[model samples]
Target: MLRYILHKLALIVPTVIGITIASFAFIRLLPGDPILAMAGQHGITPERYEILKEQYGFNQPVWVQYFDYVWGVLQGDFGISVATKRPVLTEFLTLFPATVELALVAMIIAVAMGIPAGIFAAVKRGSWFDQLTMGVALTGYSMPIFWWGLLLIIFFSGYLGWTPVSGRIALNFFLKPITGFMTIDSLLYGNWPAFVSALRYLILPSIALATIPLAVIARQTRSAMLEVLGEEYVRTARAKGLSPRRVVGLHAFRNALIPVVTTIGLQIGTLMAGAILTETIFSWPGIGKWMIDSISKRDYVVVQSGLLLIALIVMAVNLIVDVLYAVINPRIRVQ
Candidate 1:
């Protein structure tokens, strides 16, 4: 197990290097001078442009700039944002908790609702319940995230007036962010009203963000369950007169979870991608929205560093999922 873990850790080195190169190169490739962006409509004189280029190291050769960027990254300096004048890393850390909180809540909703629906659908394979569940899943998977989010906001926030249309919590509830997660912070401060407000604010965006992941998980679960149920071990468990619940839950579900776990892990990338639109639509303060804002301003430092950081997070999640394979199935550990 240690060897397997070490192998995975070692592989990350090359991937990190590759991600850094891509992040650095891709942002530079986009049309628009960061210096010009900083100048704005008033612009700057030729002398001022030359001074700014030299100050930002843009006058340096491409290779030197890349080397300097990589060296700074190694020293934990992600560069100062031209727009915000803040260290990219510092800004990212400040806002990252919100993104994590949103993604975590979204996953909880997807797993809580999706898995059981899938299990029942698999059990009743040919029934109307299965058909209806699958149809709904397909619709959810096909729907554009931006459109779905707007529809939800209209119905829930506009028409019904149940949930808040935007933001992480009600502005009226002043809860200092102890851990940066609003709900947790509310509980920590013993602010019940704030906690309730946080949950209410979270509902629509979480649902909108969860839709595709929920559909994918449900479909994967059903497929895995069906395959597991048809296996010899499941048949033997049933033949031995074990209760249906035990045979299905203990024997089949555990085995089926291997594939379902993989599907869930893969959804991290989708969640991050979908978060851009969701956060933008809902005006949620998170890394995704920050990235979008930075891109518009041509804040190359923030955009590149944010992309690299987000990719690292996704890779780390995937690593955790890989480690879970051993824990879930002893056979993998033995291998």
Candidate 2:
């Protein structure tokens, strides 16, 4: 297991390098000069533009710039955000916790709802409950996240006033961001009102972000569970007078998790992608919103570095999921 994990970790360096190269090329290919964009409404004189280019090494050869960029990244410098004039890494770190919190809550909703719906569906098979759930799952899978988020806002926030329309929490409280994650920070400070505020703010966005992933997880789980439930061991356990719950939950669900786990892992990328739309709709302060703002401003450093960091995070999640296979089944570890 350790050897396998080490091997996966070793592979990440090359993968990250490839991602960086691709992202750098892509960001450059994007039309508009980041320097000029950063100049804003006041704009810049051509003479000033040349000096700014020289300062940022835009005057250097592409190869030299790439090497220098890589070197800076290795030293933990992601360059300064042209828009904000803050270190790109610092800007990312400050905003990342919100994204993490949103994604985590969304995943929890997906897993908590999806797995059981799948298990029940698999158990019930062709029943009305199964049919209805699968129908809803299909709707969820096909629904546009942004549109869905808007509908939710219209109903829950606009009409009912049950939830906040946008933002992480009510701005008036001014909770000091210890962890940057509002829910955790609220709990740590023992501020239940703030905690409730944070949670209320989270629900719409979390549900909006969760929909597609929940559908995917449910469908994957059902498919995996169906296959596992038909296996000889499962039949043997049933014939041996094992309780149906134990046979299904303990044996079938455990065995079925391999594919389900892979699906869940793949959904990390989905969640991040969906976050862009979800954050925009909800005005959630997260990497997605930040990246969009950076892109419109043509802040090359933030765009490139943010893409690389998100890619790295996805790869790390995939690696972690791969490792879990051995733990889940034990047969893979033996092999």
Candidate 3:
């Protein structure tokens, strides 16, 4: 297991290097000049432009700049944002919790609903419940996140007036951002109203962000469950006169979870991607929105570093999921 883990950790080195190259190249390829964007309304003169470029190390050879950036990253420096003039790592850490909160809530909703829906759908097979669940999953998977968020806002926020159109909480509530997660911070401060408000604010955006992941999880869970249910051990358990619930829940579900876990792990990347659209639509103050703003401002350092950080997070989650496979099925560890 230690060797396996070390191998996985070693793999991340190349992945990180690839990410750095891609992010660096991709941001530079974008049309707008970062120095020009920084100049804003009153643009700089030719000498000023060259001076600014030199100051930011843009005047260096491309290979030299790349090596410098990589070295800085190794030293835990992601560079100062061209737009904010703040360290990119500091800015990202500040906004990361918000994105994490959003993603966590979405994952919670997906798992809570998706696993059971998939299990029952698989168990029932051709029944009405199964048909309806599959139908809904298909629809959810097909729906575009931005359009879905709008429709939700129009109906829930505009017509029904049940939820706010945007933002993390009502302006009336003031809870200090202790952990940066509004809901947790609200509870820590013993602010019940604030907690409730945070939850209400979370509903639309979480649902929007969770849509694709939930659909994917549900479908994957059903497929995994179906495959597990047909195994000889499942039939053996059933033949022993075990109750349907125990047989399915204990014997089938546990085995089914290996693949479902992989699917869920893969969805972290999707959730981050969807959060970009979802955050923009709802004006949620998360890393996704921060990245979009940085992109607009041509903040090359912020964009590149932010993309690298997000990729790192997804890779880490996948690593954890890989470790879990051994725990979930010892046969994997033995192999």
Which candidate number has the best lDDT? 3
Tens-place lDDT digits, model 3, residues 276-300: 9999999999999999999999999
TM-score of each model, paired residue for residue: 0.97, 0.97, 0.98
Stretches of candidate 3 exceeding 4 Å from the true structure: none
**161-273: candidate 2 lDDT, tens digit per residue:** 99999999888777889999999999999999999999999999999999999999998999999999999999999999999999998999988989999999999999999
- The CA lDDT of each predicted structure is 0.93, 0.93, 0.94
Query: Model 1: per-residue lDDT, tens digit, 281-310?
Result: 999999999999999888888998999889
Colliding pairs, model 1: none
* Ten-residue stretch with the least lDDT total in model 1: 326-335
Q: Rank the candidates by lDDT, best first.
A: 3, 1, 2
